[model samples]
Target: MTPAQRRRAAEQAARRLARTSLFRRARHLALYLSHGSELDTGPLLRCCHAAGKAVYVPRVLDGQRLRFERLVEDMPMQRNRYGIREPALRGARRGAARMDLVLLPLSAFDTQGHRLGAGGGYYDRAFAARRSGGPRLVGYAYALQQAAALPAEPWDVRLDAVVTEKSLHVFRN
Candidate 1:
């Protein structure tokens, strides 16, 4: 399918998820700004901002490492190395707090709950390191990005749920 088609599917899915209890229950959220091929988060971000919740975005720091900084109104944004736009905070290397919810960008995800990232493993390491007592990991993907299978590695952490524009795929522990 075309990029537009994929994005449309993902956007619809996100809209559906926005009405869910899980999304409504979240008080603190960490979400990504959608670029090419990722699920659109503009609506979700606006909702969070309007709700007066603390919103954080990731800044890719080092190899497979990312730092999350709180985003306030009218915060300056910068283009990161991955071409994703993130809120800029100079000299702000504070560790990510234990968020109530984390919205992940997914290149691909499987029915079995495996996620294929952008091949940099940034999300993999970030989730692994922060997920011990952190928020629920939710993979945001277009329905077309769902696959039959994905190659799993040790550092490749599993998600608690995968959200498409259609519905939430909650994994059983």
Candidate 2:
């Protein structure tokens, strides 16, 4: 889709997210910086900032796990081995368990909220800690990325919901 179209779609999805009770109650949100043509999260980040929410972004570690750091205003970041920008860890780290909401990036998804990631296990490893329930995991993707079906493994953590440009798909637990 065109840049204009993508922006408009992202805005629509962000609006839907804003209307959710979860977002309203969430004080800490985990978000990722959009890489390439992925649905731009710029709008969502702004909304979270305006709502007085503290946002955290994951920093990939050597152990194939993620260490989330609080995203401060104008936070300086450094790129990881994979070229993904991560917030520089200047102090003690915070994990995903502390977040109230997690907006995850997905390469593709199905109606069941099965997400296809970048083939890395960082998210899966970190998400394991959330199985007992902590933050609400939501896959952020464009409507075009949805597949009719996708294979899911025992280790592949399914999302609680997925927000697309057109609609929000909430999976049954």
Candidate 3:
């Protein structure tokens, strides 16, 4: 997709997310900044801020785990080893269990809620303890990223829903 197409699709997906009850009821949310051709979260971030929600972004810890840090206005940012931008200043952090919602980035996903991340288990490991209840794990991606099915492992964490530019797919409660 071209830059313009990406922007438009991101906006559309953000709107779909904003209409979800999960998002509306969420007071604390986690969102990842776009890296490479991933769907942009700038619009969603703005929407969360406008709605007075507390937003957090993932930060790599010890090169093996992820801890979310609150996103503050004008906070210093630095690229991670994977070239993903994260808050530079370490502030109060929260685990996935504490968030009301978490919008994850994915390379590909299936209707079964299985997601193929960037080959890293950061999100999976971060939210692994959450099986039935806790934060709503949602995948943020373009419609084209959806696949018929994807392989899953014992440690893979399923998403509650996935929001694409075309629509929203809820896999489970």
Candidate 4:
């Protein structure tokens, strides 16, 4: 899809997501900034800002760990090792367990909610401590990113749902 088409699709999906019970019930939301051709999260971020939800973005730490830092209007940002813009404050941190909902970024995913990320393992490491009752994990991506099947490793954390431009694919709870 062209850039304009992608933007439109992202906006449309954000609108759909804003109406979902998952999004509505979320008090602390974790989202990723768009990279490459991934679905742009700008629209979703805007919605979060307008709705008064506490939005957080990831910052990569040592040992492939990720810390969610609250996003504020005046907070300074910088590119990390992978060149992703993240909140510069390393002091104020929130663990994955504290998040109400997490909108994950993925390269590819399966119908069963197996995610193929950028191979960084940051997300896996961050949420490794989570039990079955942890925060809600949702993969956000374009519809074209869905795969028929993908191999899952023991450490691979499956998503609870995947919000695509077309629809929200919820996996078994």
Candidate 5:
């Protein structure tokens, strides 16, 4: 999709997300910064800020794990090994389990909540120990990214829901 198209779709998806009870109840949210043709997260970030929600973005650590740091205005930022920009490790960070909601980026997804990331296992490893009532894992992507089905591994972390420009698909209670 073109830049303008992607922006418009992202805005629509963000509006859908904002209307969800999950988004309304969340106090601390972990969101990814938009990169490449992935769905833009600018609209969601603005919505979160407007609603007085604390927003965090992931920072890659040791090229393996993800550390979520609060996203503050004018905070320092550096690109990870994959060229994804992340908040610099300066202030207190929150673990995945501590967040109320986590919006993950994906390359593809299915109704079963399986997500295909950028071939990196950072998110999976970070949430590997997630238990019941833990942070809700949500995938943020475009509707076109949905596939009929995708293979899953035993260690794969399933998403609780996936929000696309078209709609929101919930897979778990």
Candidate 6:
């Protein structure tokens, strides 16, 4: 499916999950702000802030890694090479707080719970290095991004759960 179709599906899926009692229970959430061709998360972010959950957004850094930065409505934003909106950062943000939940954007996912990123390996590598007791990984995607299977490499990390517009899928591993 095209990226647009995938995004629409994922956004609808995330909206459904956001309205669920389970997701509403989270007090602190780590949510990625969407960039070009990714699932739209504007509504989700607004819903989270309005619900009084502390929202944490990712800032891409030099190491092909991510650092969690507290997202405030007043923060300045700029477009990266990929045309995704991101907050400007003076330095690399630090530490992983105890997040009650996390929402991850994906280019693709498989029934086996593997994620296919956009080839940068940023999310894969960061997730591998994250040792703090924060939110569990939950991939957010449109149902169209679902694949029958994905090739998992040694460094590729799996998700604890995946939520598509059609359903919320949890993995046991």
Show model 4 residue runs off by greater than 4 Å.
none
| Clash list (residue pairs), candidate 3 | none
Tell me the tens digit of each residue's lDDT in model 6 across 1-173.
67676656756876787877657888767788777666678767877877887777777778476777777788888866666667776433435435677788888998888999878887676667655455578888777789999989988878878887788888866
Give the per-residue lDDT of model 4 (tens digit) for 74-102: 78888877778887776456778989999
Off by over 4 Å in 6: 1-11, 20-22, 89-94, 129-134
lDDT (10s digit) by residue, model 3, range 1-173: 99999999999999999998999999999999999999999999989999999999999999889999999889999998889999988988887898999999999999899999998899988987885658999999999999999999988998889999999999853
Show where candidate 3 strays beyond 4 Å.
none
| Per-residue C-alpha lDDT of model 5 across residues 28-112, encoded as one tens digit per residue | 9999998887899999999999999999999887878788989987788888778888876666688899999999999999979
Per-candidate TM vs. native?
A: 0.85, 0.94, 0.97, 0.95, 0.96, 0.83
**What residue pairs are clashing in model 1?**
13-165, 13-166, 14-165
Return the TM-score for candidate 2, rounded to 2 decimals: 0.94
Candidate 6, residue 90: the lDDT equals: 48
Indicate which candidate wins on TM-score. 3
Error of 1 at 95 (Å): 4.1
State each candidate's clash count.
Answer: 3, 0, 0, 0, 0, 2
Could you tell me how far off, in angstroms, the CA of residue 22 lies in candidate 1 after the best superposition?
2.2
TM-score (C-alpha, index-matched) for candidate 6: 0.83
lDDT tens readout by residue for model 1, 1-173: 67677657756776776777767887778888889857778767777777777788888775567887787778888888768898766534335547778888888888777888778877777766653656778888776778899999877878888887777899853
Q: Rate the local accuracy (lDDT) of all candidates.
A: 0.76, 0.85, 0.92, 0.88, 0.92, 0.75
